[model samples]
Target: MPSNDSLARASGNVKWWKNANIFQIWPASYKDSNGDGIGDIQGIISTLDYIKALGVNTIWISPMYDSPQIDMGYDISDYESVYPPYGTLDDMDQLIKGCHDRGMKLLLDLVINHTSDQHKWFQESRSSKTNPKRDWYIWRPAKYDADGNRQPPNNWMSCFSECAWTWDEHTQEYYLHLFCVEQPDLNWTNEECRREIYRSAMEFWLEKGVDGFRVDTVNMYSKPMDFPDAPIVDPLSKYQPAGTLYCNGPEMHKYLREMAAILARYDAMTVGELPLTPNTKDVLDYVSLKDPQLSMVFQFDLVDIGRGPVDMMKLTGYKLSALKAIINKWQTFIEGNDGWTTVFSENHDQGRSVSRFASDAPEHATNSAKLLAMLNTTLTGTMFIYQGQEIGMTNVPKDWPIEEYLDVGSINYMKLIKEKLEATGASEEEKAKAVHEALLNINAVGRDNARTPVQWDSSPHAGFTTGKPWMRVNDNYKKINAAAQINDPDSVLSFWKRMIGLRTKHSSLFTFGSFHLLEPENEQTFSYVKKSAEGDEKALVVLNFTDQAQEFKLPTEDGANWSLLQGTQPVEDPTSAPLKAYEGRVFVNFGARD
Candidate 1:
């Protein structure tokens, strides 16, 4: 059992991020100021007022570092400089100042897990085996099989559907790349390399006045020393899923502590992206208040509810019961153990929340979006809103072909599927059917769905760029966009503003509250209560997860008079009325509880 003291300490000494409402901006799709078909820092600066009006106090911009664009800036070639397509250092400085001027802090995306092979460090590292920088990255000698053919160091698959180790002809050894071949994993075991990362990747930004970082793949900094082969998950595939071999290795904690010490000196906020964190106990080791390694972690249990273990493309129908279980597990365990986690349903890597978790049809999209907003705001953790989520963005149209997809993971997965089908000696008709199904899956769960240009207006390219856009804008932008919804009282954007304002007004109850789920077994409805640690403020959030109306009985206590704080549909008496289709409501019961 965990002690209550952790919760007490968390509530006592409040951090800035604990009460923050963060909004994520993917630069390439946000706004293209110069009409270059790519978003830039100047464009972000121009939109500060708009973001501030949404009641968000923090802005987390995705990677804008100089890169080859192979992984959309995740493969950084330079750490200290901004990508030329985005803007220059002067523009970044101005953007920082602009955010601060409007009372908003800025968080940059930190991609220290790997660097582009084009990076000077990696170039020097692969120059010669005796080079001083040779040990800066993971390198292992190739293995020989029974035959004369050479093999990679281990039978590990990359996240993008290929061998994890890439052969280097010049170095005569294979280098590790958990993602694309261009993105080489760094060696955190090297003290000098770690120090360089602290200076160039972290200290440089902090000194430049940025508030903090959204650490990419933070738990994967350490790797297993033995470099052993992973268990065969798919017999047809030559490589295997090896996340267990590298994720949360022995030195992971030491590396995080070292990074945390640097962040503490500047009082910087950090939210780590933990892809495969096993449980809440493991998450606590990184975010525990006793000796904080990170301010919070983005756990994937909620987003990964219906997805496959090794291949995310193998998705199944999402169940409300499973969602409820995940919520109960994380909310209760983290709250009890005094750990912190982020509350978000969408990001650059995920499809639109409305399309995934709720109905995205024309009739139910608005209400469903509002329902998600209410649920997210009333949760007991820091909130994060992805770009285009406020106006209820949906996934790409089903008619879109594979050519429109720009995400490396999506493209690679499609190729993998095609090859597998070919290997089965299937007929052309069967192969075509498989390809069509794969495209449908990509349309539903692909990263490109969220990477489309932000729908600013009904103009060409949604006013994101004057020139041809980097990717196609959502076709539904004509009816759903920021310009059209900014002032509409009944619009999804307005609902988000109101919900965010409500959370801001009662930060204590929503941020550090004790969460209690109501009717956890109910499949069509999700309801939960949040009570402040001081036992004063209380809020009840009820949501209809289905498209049809559902009856819900509110939890009533003596001397409690529940009043509507916000709702998707008007209800005179929530306890008695049936919840409308895709409806959501937040009710507050003021005064002491018996």
Candidate 2:
């Protein structure tokens, strides 16, 4: 179904990753082959064919390492082994082979920013001040008052716990943990520690035929040499949280260069989760081909658009046009520098895109999901589709009991907010109302929304497991499951297939084209033009971000001789037509007909 011209243009793409889209999977929720109630590597191996059929040539699997599950699998206890619930090292080897057999690359989550307290390195480091591994993690002597009451070495706070410094009575010192107290921060300043961390963990995977890594907290590896006190930004905050001083630290680039050199030893690709990447300059410096520090980096500014701190109830009132402007800046910046960026709407750590950014109305959810797919794919980057995204997955039920939620961050946030409200001396009735509002907001933005088991079919447990599922499946699975949509030509699943086909047939147009936003003032519509770098081909992509009928008029200079290339709604005319709610289309420009 691909046009010959589009295929011809696509064949010009140079980098394999530039032309290939990626599929992201959260293993615990993907599928369970064994009766263990947890999705494992074997479950992923079983779905490799389905993923390949989706037209994606890469898979970014979230962490499956040995862990305490305190932070899911991010709190790694053994970098060289798999979590018992997930599978064994042999299962991982089979997964690598499965991906390779399908001509797809596999990227494991590399979470080296911290390790669980159960890790051997941390255990030995905490054993004694004279231990050889004592300096493997950040440890400092505790400060004491004249009365002999000990205080934390610094004012820094943990991202999950209220306090960052956890005391180790045996050593009589405190260790730093940017996240949970169980996951202590590694001392990247230690040369021996860095070598062991990389050689033992990373090299082990690469030698086993693993492709690369989706480096977690990639920019937070370095900390400022001087552990200075953070300026108090919130008077009522329980503890001072200072990530700005350490995130993207002075030595981060140097570390990245070293890491990149090591990665270059294998045939692989690296995309980093740069949580603190500030601007265009940082992006260019990290991913520019001239320096070649990384394949790409994930920028999170768009995901936090409307949410307040820690998924609070406060809303930012962000508009669609504002999102267009922000994306345009990054796209233009990357395209100009010969660097690359990634395009995605939802991942393991965030809520579903359809429910948060687009309409989740029963009447319009499918179309909105399709619109988001069109917007993300037509942009100039390698696209990543999360599981269930191809089938229009909705958020969990808003009234889900707090006890059913499993994300530690969300649980901690709930407790933090409830405590804050009670501290205000408000009446119980007022406090209850405030707490209810916060819970609703959490239901909207919580990570649990994306962590629910994949809705494979309408069978019990949504066909994810014959045994009990780790989490509850969405009640709408009966109507929205993959079994119901895969056969329907008009379903979200079919639309995603069509989108990926267009991407492959016109890879050059997406990989090297210059992106320009059209009608940046349009509040309800997102429209853009992508012209091939050599000016031989050009296309227009228009998407209705809202669930309401709308019309769009291209600039007169664009000319009216356009032909429809792909569309979510039936095309009546190429240049002018009434678009249904959440409708979108990609059109190719023909020279002006005099």
Candidate 3:
């Protein structure tokens, strides 16, 4: 019964990780080399020819392991070294031999469900409770309170909050740390802690040739095998942190089919960020090429759709029919189930899809970052591209003070919204105007807006450092850099190299196409149309998501016989073209389709 029709049944084997685009790279705000102000791995092997001139073939990065950067390198400690201010292990073996001599494909960033309580196997599993690395991590034993106090082995919590247990006091016990008590959590039902987390951190980078793994926090690595308690639903929301009693648990697909039988003896590429909720049967049990445990799975339900609540301060107006009904409900359930997905809208923990879903209005931020790179390179999947999103990066300047925030989940969610506005006894001038309007709704969903830097030009640190820049560079890097939009042929990094050269000149119209969400209750227009499952290729797209002028129609009932092919704002007479505001075109039907 598992059928969305199985994402257009494609087991015909099409790897290079199914037409990847990737990119991510937070490595200390990408590019600093030796000046010590962070960023290394020889500043991403000297920007691998500016990420192979942005046609992006895959470069994930992000963790740069051996950490103690607390939460920055996601507190790893040492999964086989390399985080001395981001370089070593022969600068990650020359960044996997300079991204396989440029035809790129590096990945890495696989944070193994946790470690780094200064990990020496969590300091000999908190040294004591019979330390033969005492159960490798996740401890327990506190729950007292029969008015005798000492209570925390249950009501979980810490997703950077106040309590996902912690105690220890010399192994009297209470460990678990669902994020940031310097990380901890591991014990994956200890099959020798899942074979030393897949042989000391994923077979030491797939035996050094590194071409996969973005898996950090891949559904919080299996839980619920007993450690219960989280079911108070909402008794006035107190300690409400069950996240389905430990996110996507139940032996998460039997420990992702034991790391997909060691990533099927290495033809790699894994993806998996998956904070969840974009369900197509748990994303076809992790990108099913008939049970293949992940080659795709970012899906955070369109970045938690219109993020609101948490001492709110406005910023949730969505409706382009709620982002085309959550991107056509995960593009019609991963195009009928054979599943694979990742089309990302900003990453390094989001907030800069041209400033959260388009339009940073400096005359519509490079036409809304070229209509979010023509809706993530004419959708279908494997797109990613986060590092300073092409060239139109935005956000991080709505009055920068919360101590110039360096995200530990946006500084513990602005000190838990200034301790719930000083417990509503308000007025310290209304709790400093509700924490400066919740730090302008946490600077519109922050993750330091994709951790700043990588502007690469407008110098003085925008060229990403000769020193002094572990963060904070987005002073619109002299009108967005990359040496001023790398030879601007109508920039936004040349409409992301002309939508990655029309996804390599219509690669099966964005791969095995048949997605159709056109005007699915279009409120501010987002249209769609792919086709090509042998119905002789087609395209379509549209867009606009508001700024004003809207009137569109062209699902081609004779829209002057479709043609345009790529646009930001060019209607020019498709039977009375209107679109404009954040316009994005695309069209293509050389005829056929009644």
Candidate 4:
């Protein structure tokens, strides 16, 4: 159902990713074949059949390159080598072959924004100010305070709640690290640095036969030339939010174009993790067909709906209207401009879709999961299914203590909370209460919620690993594991299969069709219509987002011959009866539009 004009523009340039359903695998928690309490390439190769059976045609594995695991593989020390814990180069080859043999494409996670501090490039860059590789990373001389004490070059804050600049006494300078101090930001402004990245990160993987790359922190490759302090948003905090100064800097598009030119040689898929840049027009600069850069981008607006401005841990209730506006804006603007975007509700860094966007309560969990599946597949974009989302994984248990959390972000945020409470001189009882509330909020919104090991079966370790898992399996795995639902007709797993199959069977209507939101202000229901390019095929999707039944009216003008294609709950007449809690339905109209 792609428009003739759009098709003409992409003639002889059609990409396989246009219709692909990508499944993301966070390798560490996916499965373990070595019994070493960690997942590896062999474990992923073992599960290729299971992933393909879910109707996904592409698999995007998080970083498996040689790393220190400070940020769980995001901090790459060696771009050309596989981590010893994961496997050797031969194991990675088998994973690529395993995916190719199943007719599935593989995308390796690319972390070029920064590298592990232990990387050889950084090691030499920091050895001395006169080293040949000294300029490979950002380094600035220290500044003096009013008390004549040495301080960092700027007041920029790290994403992990610390000063962005780290002092290096050996070089007599401070270096930049936007994340953990163990991960240093590379100097993309250096032409030699950029050349090396293209050679090692892109060309090396393309030679390995990967289908494409998923660039992490893609928009942050460039930083402002002038070191500047961000306006103080948190008076009590010493450092300030500096993402605006670094994200989508002046030279970002130039770097992307250079990277894209190289990727074009292999005709590879390129999806970038574009954080902090939310405007659709700004996003189009990177993904628009007029001036192509990335194949698509993962915009954070939808996931960041209820997060606080300064601290993501400060949680609040999200309104359905806000969610609807974000979806409508991205879906319409991106597609309308001949740009592309990924449709996803969950990922490695987010809480489970069912727990975050829908109800995860026992009474509504299954139905709500199906409802979310319907919404994701019906939208006009490539779909990405995070691991464990297909079987309705929820957040970590509420009773879990703070010590069990493993994510650096979660741990850092909690540490900051404890320090703040102490600074206020709160009593021990008051401190305990404040800490407990913070832990509850982290349980609800932390990255560790999705980092729990996958529940393959109801075994001691949920069948994820024979040895103890690096992370704990959710306690509810006994009732919710994939093994329990693989064969059940009404299980979340089966429902996901059906939903994916429906999207595939009608790819034109689901992928390239025109989207029209229905009842935009409705608080209890989300409904939309997708019309094929020829106007002969149309699909109407209706979803109830609340815990109570809600009445909805079908559009009289769109006609009365609509037939129910699928539903989360059985319904004889969808329009006549009120929708049950968390219910969803899809109706198809095959007649030509007037």
Report, for every candidate in turn, its global Cα lDDT versus the true structure.
0.89, 0.83, 0.77, 0.88
**TM-score per model over all chains:** 0.98, 0.95, 0.34, 0.97
lDDT of 1: 0.89
The digit string of per-residue lDDT tens for model 4 on 1-594 reads 456634432343546898899999999999999898998889998889999999999999999999999999999999999999889999999989989999999999989989999999999999999998899899999999999999998899999999999999898999999999999999999999999999998999899899899899998988986888899998878899899999999899999999889888888989999988877789889998778689999988888888898888877778898899899988777554668767999999988888889888988988989999999989877899999999998998899998899999999999998888888899999999989988988887899999899999998899999998999888889988999999999999999999999998887678767788988998889988887655677898999999999986666674547878888998767866789999999989887463
Model 1 C-alpha lDDT per residue in residues 377-444, reported as the tens digit of each score: 88878899999999999998889989999999999999999888888888999999989988988888
| Residue 149 Cα positional deviation in candidate 4, in Å, after optimal superposition | 0.9
Q: Is candidate 1 or candidate 2 better by TM-score?
A: 1
Candidate RMSDs in order: 1.7, 3.3, 22.8, 1.6
Candidate 3 has an lDDT of 0.77
Q: Model 3 over residues 426-525: C-alpha lDDT tens digits?
A: 7798888877877887788777777878788887978788878877787878888888878978888888888887886776666546678865786787
After aligning candidate 2 to the native by TM-score, how far in Å is the CA of 48 from where it should be? 0.9
Q: How would you order the candidates by lDDT, starting with the best?
A: 1, 4, 2, 3
Tell me the TM-score of model 4.
0.97
Clashing pairs in 3: 4-336, 6-336, 6-338, 7-335, 7-336, 7-337, 7-338
TM-score of structure candidate 2 = 0.95
Question: Cα lDDT for residue 165, model 3?
Answer: 77
